[model samples]
Target chain A: MLNCKQTTKLLSEKQDRPLSFRERVALRLHLIMCSGCTNYDRQMGFIRKACRRIGGDDAK
Target chain B: MNSERDGNTSKAAELWLQEAEIATLRRDMLRFAKLQLRDVATAEDAVQEALSAAYATRGRFAGRAQVKTWIFSILRNKIIDQIRSQTRHPTRSLTQDDGRNAEVGALFDDGGYWHKAARPADWGDPEAALGSEQFWVIFEICLNAMAENTARIFTMREFLGLETAEICTELGISENNCWVILHRARSRLRLCLEENWIKRG
Candidate 1:
């Protein structure tokens, strides 16, 4: 089982590339039990959305 | 005939830089400067200077988009000049990630478990925070707190919409290095925001 440290790092890496099938399954399983990592995942999604919105604002 | 010709040029200048557009454009310039310069006060000063310089040369501005591009160029130069004039802050060094990783490492205990105090709380309706002006102020503070290279890489990927391979090529760093920097930046930003914004809630 991946530890929280590895789980968090993997979640960040997921932003830059597609996680392997096994990796994805492992992360999903981990998030099922790890509330902290689950929250981290959602926060990452929110941050990404925020960045894109602000970046789009610059064009106009 | 000469008065009529002068009238055409003045009208074209007015169309290129309307009074209302200047207010919107200044905000854009200020945002750009703050991201790069990292000091809000300095960023505002740079934008002010750039706008003044652009105003002096406003007659030459050709179109709306052209005026934006032109003023942004001036702002970039102004920031570069400010960065050079000051004794460089060591924190601005690109290789500051090692120090940042050390700080991140402190958050986890030896078996790689989240430390008791560091466990992230569920951020209820986090997107709602984005709607407030205060939220952006805190967000900017968190982004400014990142390591120098990490901030650059993060902004390039997140803000500039650059791909991983393109970033690696542009920065002449290895692909692995690029991912490492990005990962570090992402994690840090999350922690920073959670600490400052979510925890406050």
Candidate 2:
């Protein structure tokens, strides 16, 4: 039900951890048929993890 | 039995304090600090000093923001202090009219232009790329490319774990304006990295 922009924002927030029930359902519904947003989600997650790993090295 | 209870209580208290300690917030705090000071050692010292203050005043940490966010607020103050304390004066003026600046015109044409900024890739498969090492290069390049102030704001909100409200309060900007600055910073970074790192390959 969420638009691509909202979906993308939620996906970014979810990257930090598990999504809430409403968000989980919304993301599932959105990704079920929307390839672009799904790809966006994946990319966002990748960037976050990459940055965190880089941060991990700096903390040492 | 009483002694055992007291020992357990002490252990629990220690763990609680450790969880709220500044070192626990290092990953993001240092990143934010480095953005300001531009030197890793100086940034680390600033963050360490902020953490010490936070520990001393841990009770003041309103749970409204994440622990990382609270520590970052302290770090910001510390960085400002360090900058203000620097007593060294510049050896030479930075006037552009000096003959030494005459060569600068060659970097651009008579119309005044530099290299066209890069654009982000279409992000063909974001899911597959997330958590990849190559992505870190993009992240670093994009982050570093941002304006110092923009980078500070974004790093504080996203990397350092502060809420938009807290950031706005500290930076003395409106809520909507804070979001705007963050958005611009992210977009610029995305475009810069897309052009430099992704397209190059």
Against the unseen true structure, what C-alpha lDDT does each candidate score? 0.77, 0.57
Which residue ranges in model 2 land beyond 4 Å of their true spot?
A1-30, A57-60, B1-32, B36-138
Residue A26, candidate 2: how far off, in angstroms?
6.2
Model 2 DockQ reads: 0.08
lDDT of 2 by residue, A1-60 (tens): 776555655665553346689889988997897665565555555555444433332331
Model 1 backbone overlap count: 0
Q: Would candidate 2 be rated incorrect, acceptable, medium or high by CAPRI criteria?
A: incorrect
What lDDT tens digits, residue by residue, belong to model 1 across residues B42-149? Answer: 889988998889888777776666667677778766765564444234334354446668877888999998998888778888777766877888888888888666
TM-score of chain B of each: 0.63, 0.49
Candidate 1: residue A29 lDDT (0-100): 90
Give the poorly placed runs of model 1, Cα more than 4 Å off. A57-60, B1-22, B37-98
Weakest 10 consecutive residues of candidate 2 chain A by summed lDDT: A51-60
Least accurate 10 contiguous residues by lDDT in model 2 chain B: B87-96
